[model samples]
Target: MSTVTLQEKKSYRIMGISLPLFGLITVGVLTATYMEVLPKGMIGAFALMMVLGLILNEVGNHLPIVKDYLGGGSIVIIFGSAALVTYNVLPESAVEIMSNFMRGEGFLDFYIAALITGSILGMNRELLIKASVRYLPAILGGVAVALGLVGLVGAIIGYGAKEAILYIGVPIMGGGMGAGAVPLAQIFGSSLGVDSGEMLSVMVPAVALGNAVAIVVAGLLDRLGKTKPNLTGNGELMELENKKAEAKEEVEEKEEKTAINFPMMGRGLLLAVSFFTLGSIIGKFLPQVHSYAWMIISVAVVKALNILPREYETGAFQWFQFVMTNLTGVLLIGIGVAFTNLQQVIDAFTIQYVLLVAVTIIGCVIGSGIIGKFVGFYPIESSITAGLCMANMGGTGDVAVLSASDRMKLMPFAQISSRIGGAFMLILASTLLRFFI
Candidate 1:
């Protein structure tokens, strides 16, 4: 234990010393973005550097334009890489195993549990962010409802409850195709009696196809929307104007402030540890223990409770960001490495397998798109969100899809609504299907 602690400290120290190197790279890249002439490989390099830049920021340093742009960019990188890997668009072995373990009746236990836990934690975080923020109450309340449903469904269905689980995870993870093949594997496992090894390979292509389906559908929607502008409503115009005003205010505030000072690292670390422990305790006691869910939820809840003051110290925010960034990085990197071991799954794709994937993709696009339209989002935005659900087939994808579409100037609230509905159905349907199929 002592050795490990020492090593960890040493690693952090090394990271601290190495911060400037990353900052330098980030600055160089930012200059390019400003000039609108960033090279190709620089794009990937920039994405990778953003996370490092945030770490540097936490430790107290500045690297010109890099600090501002790259830090936030890290969030994007974390999101995008996870999306690519989760959907099997990227050939990473760790994703294969995790996705497999994530699939089916057995898989639902952990994920659904996590969904519940994350919401609870997120609410606590929301409270910390601002109790008066009008949106927090409703959102947190919805999360509670979703959590309860997930736990109830998981307890009753067991491993067969994967479809239900996917529905839940899909919205949470990244929406549609990014939601990935865990649900299909669940279905295949229970209904077809397919082995885990065989199912892993079956799911990869399905995930990719789902994502592709989403993109194509979204693109088509974009084209269609061009012909009928603002069919989605003009609520976003107001939102955009407000955001711009907020940005200007923030810029003025930054000028008045000295060096950015985040809160101490201790608080976030303590909160993270608390949540991890709490999750473990809850997961163990739950009828069908899903520890990961507990861990995730606990983290969010603990952080929320600990950090939700109206006037948080700068150091506190910095530490909290660090903790979250590190947590996300470790989990994702672990998933990436883990997927490397599942080569067998991809080696034996059959005709039936191909068809199954095709159908799933189609279903995701059509289902998600219809839901988006009903919610009054621009067609492109709705389709992307739908595609995210249908393709990678998860919430993270939903966020990414929505965010991506927003970049393309599409209305994204539809994405949010789609997720709310899709996640509920995805989990419930998947779990219930187990018994009949």
Candidate 2:
């Protein structure tokens, strides 16, 4: 008899399903979708997104150069899905379902609500207050430098300084599409007596291209941090000199001791939704501020005042971890399929246009990094949150950029840049159009 019995093969999985089973499920889903017999609403939408997202994510993370420097799976998920849609690789019916689920049904909002509520609630109260006080100035520094640099380059390249600032610089830094560019198009149209659609035509490409650049640069920055460890705080945004390292260690120890509680995650979900609801209600009253900004403020206030119990805080953190670990790939798929327009990005890739966008991003990085250092934050973290976050496409862009940088903990600051910084751009654009137009 043979001395050794046959060894069992190890199973490989994607999204928790073993490879063989997952392949069968993927085939069935695609067949159903192709035949237009896929179930409607969340059931159909979630299945398709999950399948596409996991496949793309796995491939992206494994590619050699792409994994090392090009934002790994995060970049692949967004642009890969965008290319699929652009090339008609995905069925139109399937695309429509994904779009409706992501935008029409507000899946992005639900994900962001949990992230913001949980992230803020779980933060150290002292660090939160200290960082929040200085964050706005860092954001302003990025905006100022990005716009100025783009305008200077535009004039040098004969692209027209004022037009470059208005079209390229402002849109790139104005947050994302809905909160930033759409409103900006309306403002520009009314001021210049042109159609808002025309204004959008020019701005949309800038947002898309800027978002792509932000993701790439974020990945590069992460690599830079690894090579030069002093440049980054890992995930910690600021250096709290007065705060003892032992205290942080103690907190981490306590966190490790707390086992994952299913009921606690349920409470976390409820809390996240409730805070988001409160933000919406407040937005109704304060129409000028974005609901996300209000939500950040509300969460910070609750945290600062110690209004919530410790258990609830831990619960929120647990929920955030769960969503971040599992749903990020799915969300990236939604963003690519729904928000990105590959054709627009390609059409806008003139030498001058590329240079202008690049200059804007570089300026943002330099300016925010310098200012952020003065205010006690690590340069890499500041540039990612205050600089690249501002230049990327609003909420979706924030997630992508942070994901690329491996700094999901900075969600609170990224939201501030997208919502508050974007709101500021609208005001600036409104004021500037008066003179330029």
Model 2 TM: 0.70
Regions more than 4 Å wrong, model 1: 1-209, 227-263, 294-333, 348-351, 372-380, 386-437
Candidate 2: give the clashing pairs.
176-393, 176-394
Q: In every candidate, how many clashes are there?
A: 73, 2
Give Cα distance to truth, residue 121, candidate 2, Å.
Answer: 1.9
Could you estimate the TM-score for every candidate?
0.44, 0.70
lDDT of 2 by residue, 302-384 (tens): 88899999889889889987987788777778767876666765676799998898889988998899898888778999899
In lDDT terms, how accurate is model 2? 0.78
- Residue-level lDDT tens digits of model 1 in 24-96: 6557755654454544332333243344334433432244432222222322333344455556654333233
Alpha carbon lDDT of each predicted model: 0.38, 0.78
Q: Model 2: which ten-residue window has the lowest total lDDT?
A: 248-257
| Shift in Å, residue 9, candidate 2 | 4.5
lDDT of 1 at 293: 40
